[model samples]
Target chain A: MTDLEAGREALLDHVEALIAQRGGVSITLAELAAAAGMSPANLYRFFENKEALYEAVAERWFAPKVRAMEEVLASDLPIRQKFYAFYARRLGMICDDYARDPALFRSYLELGQQHIEIVRGFIDLADHFLAELIAEAIAEGYFPGLEIDSAVSLVNLMLQTFCDPELVVMLIHSVSEEKLAIVVDTIFDGLRGDRPSNVRRLTRAAR
Target chain B: MTDLEAGREALLDHVEALIAQRGGVSITLAELAAAAGMSPANLYRFFENKEALYEAVAERWFAPKVRAMEEVLASDLPIRQKFYAFYARRLGMICDDYARDPALFRSYLELGQQHIEIVRGFIDLADHFLAELIAEAIAEGYFPGLEIDSAVSLVNLMLQTFCDPELVVMLIHSVSEEKLAIVVDTIFDGLRGDRPSNVRRLTRAAR
Candidate 1:
């Protein structure tokens, strides 16, 4: 990467750490400038305002998440494995990122009209990727005779359930990682055309 | 209902309407009392404080939603129908309630710990109902050879998607009722055991 690109990334890292510590409420451009060892005027050369910096931070945080899914989508893995890996990676990234800096999560949630459309555009991109993946899976008989639209919606629902701020807050407070994994597995098992035999074994054990 | 019950219900209704109009930030007990043709001191007999009154108003609004789901669960409708009806009712209630009072939705989103617990309890109840319905559906061969736990999780995921605040906010702003209905229907179809022919028709139309 170019020196300027490296500097931009370093600035974003500093901003994310600060935002996480402050819960996205009290961020000031001066503080960010100081943290990045740059003058406020110099910082403005990179970002117009605090909000622009925030948008950059959000973009930086979400880029890896989208890239991870793209990697899974492009892999030669079976459709079920591809879908599961994509979602699991997404969920794990979110959980790990939130654990490292919950303020970033809070900031994303607080994004208003200025960023909402941009965020929605990214979401639409993800949705399109997912829809195509589902279509390909069904066409290849990896999932038997699945309806494309419903499958897309189901995947969207699954993503929402795992990423829901309220549910995630509660789950992180009281739920174990093992249990969360099981829940994710169960959700995918329902979505997939074929069920693993161990699913029955696990169900019986739970009972 | 008894006269006291009737009077209490009337007071709660007045308070809800006032809060709806005033965005829950400006409504005062005195104003509510005046609207109900009672003294502010008399209003105190019905609610201990503003928070308590707000909780009561929320309870009054949500009680029917709970009742409707409970009734569906208890009724003899097919599992698919029961699931569809439950979610349809839930989405409708959320949309209608938000239309009447956006503050009510905001308040619920910002609910304190005690209220969060109440909301969680409601979610757990719905989860249990979904589990039961899925179990029955599997037993009836609606989903032949289905994994029950996974199916239950998927159902929960579907329900959660409908109520996810972030997604709801986006949909409310950008989607029509017809589009929302399609979203709901597609999700349920995805969860259904077999691919329905109508999915292709819908997908083509959407394209």
Candidate 2:
């Protein structure tokens, strides 16, 4: 990498360490520069402002996760196994972030609508990977009659607790692997097409 | 009602109005007492502390929702329709709470683990109703092999985004009714039984 890029990566290491130490992003630019043995002015050359720095931090934290999800999508595993691995990985990483520094993770999440600009690219990338999987599944004759985009949106919507960072922290403790399996199983059932004929007949008889 | 109950209800009315006006629950006991045209000492007779007051508020808000869900469960609608109505009513009420006052709703939600004591009974009541519906579905031979508690827990876990107060506020906007329908449909398929034979054959062929 170029010297400038190397310098930025090194600086980000210090920033992440300090954030983990403080359990938040409340550390100032000057503090970060001091931790890196540099002047605030030098830090400014790398990151224009605190938000810019945070944007980098968010990107650095988020990009690898997107790549990992993409890797899962590209794997030759059974489609059902791939779906479980994809979400389990996503949930595990976010839960790790929350466990590592809840305050810092929460600040990033609590940025809500305001911080969308910083992380929108990462979000879209991840969603694109998810869409790719859904499209593949549709092509393979799963989720028959469902439009790809709508099906993708619906799956993402249902999986929000597993994917939305804030929900992950609040609700993850209760989410066991068994529960995750059940949910994924349900999604598979839903995507595999209409309700089973036996089920429909039973419902009709009951009614 | 008894005089004491009448007076307490009147006091709660003032508290609710002040909470709405301020967009939070930060109003002091003295302020609430003044708003109710009573001395703080008299207010103490109604609510021993802020936590107690908030508990009453939570109960008042939550009890009706539980009752509403029970009504849905009792209705002669098809099991599938009952499922949709049950969750739609829940998502609707929480979203309404958020729309009316985001700050107050957030404070209540942010109370997190600490606030469980006040809300646990209400939560259990709601879960009971959910379990009842799931048990009914199972009894009708849907989810033929699943245990009732596991089925109910899995369904609840999957629906956390709709039911978890904090997630509801963060995610409610993106959740269209069509999306909710898709999720409920998926859950129905999941609950109704194993993979369809045709889909199984298709998947095996794709492999």
- List residue ranges in candidate 1 displaced over 4 A: A26-31, A48-52, A111-114, A142-151, A163-207, B24-37, B48-52, B98-114, B131-135, B138-154, B163-207
What is the per-residue lDDT of model 2 for residues B119-191, given as tens digits with 9 covering 90 to 100? 7877778788888998888777777677777777677777776776766676666775456666777777665
| Residue pairs with clashing backbones, model 1 | none
TM-score of chain B of 2: 0.79
- Candidate 2 residue lDDT tens string, A1-207: 998889889998998778657654356788989999999898888988888887778878787687779788888977776777778777878878778767778766755345677777777877888888888777777787778777777787777667767666777667655556667667876754344433344434655
Best by lDDT: 2
Q: Provide TM-scores for the models.
A: 0.72, 0.84
Query: Which tens-of-lDDT digit does each residue in A85-203 have in candidate 1?
Result: 66666667767766876766766566523466656666777788888788877787644435776566655654555654435654554333333443334334444533332322332
TM-scores for chain B, listed for all candidates: 0.64, 0.79
Local error of candidate 1 at residue A198 (angstroms): 28
